[model samples]
Target chain A: MKKQWYDYLWILSLTYLILGFFNIMFAWLGLICFFVPLLISLIKGTKGYCNRYCGRGQLFGLLGGTFGLSRKKDIPKWMKSKWFRYGFLIFFFAMFFLMLWNTYLVFAGARDLKEVVTLLWTFKVPWHWAYHGTLIHPGAAQFAFGFYSVMLTSTVLGLITMVLFKPRSWCVYCPMGTMTQIICKIKDKK
Target chain B: MSSIRKKRKAFVEQADCVACGCCVKVCPLGAIRIISGIMAQVDMEKCVGCGKCAKECPASVIAVKEVTA
Candidate 1:
């Protein structure tokens, strides 16, 4: 198939990552990636965002399809099962809520903003170098750091699965995909 | 010459389709669409049976088959 304009969107994902690395404030931009899929799903009642417009999916396709970085193997059946997909979605929402809680803590002045990005909700990698003392409320920056960690962590997982399986294998289990799928179903019912 | 013509069309196995939308993305003709966010339904009239959707389908539920018309 000929490349469409959206095929080049992978660069946006890469650029977002690079920008976030240089200045943590750029992490707030990740909300575009986070929210756009849902809005599309709600309004369009389709997985069009996941299918055609996801920069992360495009990135994986470029790395694994064009560059041949993947094994091109089929993802395992268990990972594609409904139980696992829904379970992972729930886990993802839990992590998102935890990030929100941490941001709320910072917002409430109950805790200072942590200058670290937690990977996989476990390892807190010190990100002091990314912090340059933003004048914005520390809570906002705190949310940025937490949100960036979530985005980066998911990208890492996507890359790993892309290398192991098909280029777009991550689409099978992506939380946003699941959420959008649910939204599409609900919209279809209406 | 035989009156019957063999036309290739894409058929989706609804039972197995995960509705991942991978096929929907790769269909050059926009022949495949997700059915209520569930399974992929191919528009037989538009599907040229190029096999792109079948190849792109992660669930391997899409198949291009020859149909006699």
Candidate 2:
């Protein structure tokens, strides 16, 4: 049973589309669906979920591998700099903290749609435009932001990684990857 | 010929594993288990080389290769 690269791509896209649709509709369940595979993948290997079932991973892996950009054969010292790794980790964690803060606000009965939209606007980045006038309600923006922040932060980190180092550098400092590595280490110890 | 085939089903390589557990879950003969704190390993005698485990492993790590009887 030889596997083609596209088989992984198909699985990933299917999972993403199904999970994304469910997430956008039910909110909490969507969050669960999104993080669970990530948790599983991290514990297993990126190859398990990222390569096998993540649409974003599949897309990036395909694009990078196709162009001979996927393999990280000769990474530079600067790209592997501890400062850069720590910086990205700190930034990723900060985004997670902000998501938590927003979640706290939502739970505290502050449900003003305008206020939520305004807060997002304060970020003043172009990507916020995608969330500007969507069907997403104000009460739900925090949850949305939690997901969006991780995605956005990773995207930014990914761009930096692609530019400064090898294309898949985000995998090195990715919080999700970090979490998985931690799990794998623990699994190894026991 | 059939006796020669029986000798070939023992070893597994850990490096190529993606750890999806498909092999662990689908082993009809109950020959494979994902070792605790390690990757999957196969119990040779129990393996029938039905190819179920190899078929399901997402990483394509498991192979039914010939070995010494």
Candidate 3:
């Protein structure tokens, strides 16, 4: 079936990004927005939410493919390997756990959210230095971490894949996409 | 003379699919999906009869019939 206008889901990220920069609690709404649809896709045994309705996926298509030109080439062979996808999954979980730990520290009063937000570590690059942003909206640090992790990663992935391959190529190896594919398969047994 | 007719749309042999997901990348219409992570099944509704997936399939499992119904 042809994709409809509403199928574009990535456009919604603008809201999430703005929310995260302002109020933290509201930004978490983005998580709930996505996880819920993904949960449903598992039960439905179809990537309806992803293929037909994901905002971020739609954004990639709109910005990278529809309005712009994509290379329409194939991704690197290593990118399609199970090792690369699983390795990314592991790295994502590690960062997720660390985000959780940071949140725990704030809630436990051991290091407060304020300190965590203000905390800075600079890494000098050959040309310059890079530092984590100083200001995070007022909300759960976990939510901030989750939001940034997703937005930055998606943006980077969308940009790279759009250039190297097609706009939707990132979907092939997306950690969550892979996880849902696994889940839907497990849910259907002979 | 009947052989002159165009080939029908492609279909999966099921037993031959390796579920490598290579075809999924090449398909512009997103007509193919790995069902249960085991078999790559084609969505007839979404497939516009384009054979990009079949062309990209490494296993040679997807084939179109020379004769049409």
Candidate 4:
């Protein structure tokens, strides 16, 4: 059980969250997390990103396995079913687009810049402390707020599932994992 | 080029398996399953021995081994 370089990647997940808290601009870095999985799955035709490079998944594994925070129960069968996985993927994208729409509103000057991060799309946590009024378009900052919310919300969900079930149980229904898996399947067919 | 070629299949060292289900998600053929939250069981019939699981496994308890048909 020797640790590889990738094994320590969980630190990146934590660091991203922390950096985003102090400065919302750091949220743009999440685009790397967003796109790299799809790019790897497309080019390599494997779940290589989710399997080895996902910092969030590794964070859950570290918390649930190394720290023994997990109850070690099996995720329910329904969670692994194709129907639930696909449904979740769809829902996740809808929320993502909605976040973008909000950002667009700010960009278009139709809405005021929301100086808060919405957690799980419900509770809005005032985040003005993170933004000191950048000279850049407020829309960019708005996107960072929204994107950080998405990242944080997913991480919280992963942690919850990790404590309630298997350490990496969130991987069963992760939207990125589902998208990459679909990409892998399509590429393997060619 | 022997007539009988060696085939590799995933074998889980059950005693050491953390049953994290990383292998189950990465198996392209859906060949691995966690048995009641305990350990990963590989379905040799479905597994292609891609070693994706072996490499993805954090515990490193899964080994791809050559098996005779």
Candidate 5:
């Protein structure tokens, strides 16, 4: 198969993810980077992001593909079941909204930044150990949290899918992918 | 190309299936699998109705059908 153009997007994301952990200002990019694809998916559908330029998916492949650490095996039947897919989608949406709400509260001064930073839902995975590799100053904590949250969410889902199935497998059941499909269905109808 | 497009997912005719793994290998989502090392099976949830398997199948047994509610 021919190499796709977007296959290289991982380089940019990988750079930001690794270097941003140190310069928290660069980490702030994660806060807004999601919208670029969300807008495109509204027009071109999930394929715009999932099939083409998903950085997280590329990272998963880099870490777990043939040359990487993971061994390939057939995914279990239960994991492929409809119940698990939809349930994960629902849970994902709920957490997404909750994160936004918490962020809003911090910005509006209704809640402390510390509270938002340490929210129970902001779960981090082992990949974050790389960021701790940097000597993060206290002043950059806000940006660090944004960087951490974005990586945490994507890495959590990516790792789960990679461990259970193939790295790209999660794209099939992603909430954003599902939402993009719904948008395309509506557009096709009109 | 069929100009009359239908939102179709892959459907396998059991009798015509030779258990050849072409479709399984070609499927982007890994949605098609050989069950018990015998027949080909499609996972509807994983399938985006992409028709990649149909185009790749050697047996000419798999076709995409309109799955309207």
Candidate 6:
């Protein structure tokens, strides 16, 4: 295969530039796109976006593929222990609940976009560096809070997953991946 | 035609593969193919160690290594 510097750049640019911008504005839609590729990867057994598409993945893939830095050998048995997997599941659901509660707050008019943003920034959390929107406004704070909650939940889950499950565990248990796996199983059975 | 024997470098562990097709889809040289009865294979001659296949294989079954030219 022809490995070009441009391919790596394109993946980074699309992920950080296009996806990052859309995620800040159309949060739900952005989540869908972000998670869908992960789900597709899990069910299909491919890194999907991470291998060729994700900005983060591109960075890592380039380092590993070019410099031989991040290439994995064997996933240690302790890392893949049942306790870790189950613990991840618990954390995943808990985060999901938190996300739901945050969403409820938004719909119930208990919060707004600005409030969410401030809460996130106050917590020293940065969702996407480029499009932070307004920092001090109430609506922006609310938006940040809601946005950051999702980001935190996913980030924590992703970190644990990678450390424990071969650097792609989030792709397997992702709600999007869960849904797709279910669908794929059903299709296989049929 | 230059006659030089190319070293074999394609390593696939079927037992570990989840058959995600990321290798097949991302292979810039179209070297990897998934046979739907449920296994995947790599065409050694076509593979150039771009590492796209190995990078995308979620199961980590595909590994690319450098061999003598």
Clash number for each model: 0, 1, 5, 0, 0, 22
Order the numbered candidates by TM-score, best leading: 1, 4, 3, 5, 6, 2
Per-residue lDDT of model 3, residues B10-68, tens digit only? 68877544454656656788788877555688877676667777655534457654435
Q: Give the DockQ-based CAPRI class for model 5.
A: incorrect
Worst 10 residues of 2 chain A by lDDT: A112-121
For all candidates in order, state the fraction of native interface contacts they contain: 0.38, 0.02, 0.10, 0.02, 0.00, 0.07
Off by over 4 Å in 1: B1-9, B15-18, B46-50, B64-69
Q: Which residue pairs come into collision in candidate 3? A: A9-A54, A9-A55, A9-A56, A10-A55, A10-A56
lDDT digits (tens) for residues A137-161 of candidate 2: 5546556645544554455556554
Query: Between the candidate structures 3 and 4, which one is better when assessed by DockQ?
Result: 3
The interface root mean square deviation of candidate 4 comes to: 9.6
Misplaced by over 4 Å in model 2 are A4-34, A37-47, A67-73, A78-87, A114-123, A126-137, B1-69
**Second chain alone, TM-score for each candidate:** 0.95, 0.75, 0.76, 0.92, 0.83, 0.74
Evaluate candidate 4 and give its CAPRI docking class based on DockQ.
incorrect
Cα lDDT for residue A30, candidate 1: 91
What's the TM-score of each model vs. the native? 0.89, 0.51, 0.68, 0.77, 0.59, 0.51
* Candidates 1 onward: DockQ, in order: 0.47, 0.05, 0.22, 0.08, 0.06, 0.13
Worst 10 residues of 4 chain A by lDDT: A43-52
Query: Lowest lDDT 10-mer window, candidate 6 chain A?
Result: A113-122
- Extract clashing residue pairs from model 2: A23-A30
RMSD of 4: 8.1
Model 5 residue A4 CA deviation (Å) reads 4.1
lDDT of 3 by residue, A8-62 (tens): 4566766665555554444457666458656765667655555445666666666
Model 5: per-residue lDDT, tens digit, A115-182? 12233354433333333423544334444564466555566666776665554455445555555544
Error of 6 at A86 (Å): 8.0
State which candidate, 5 or 6, has the greater DockQ: 6
Return the top candidate by lDDT.
1
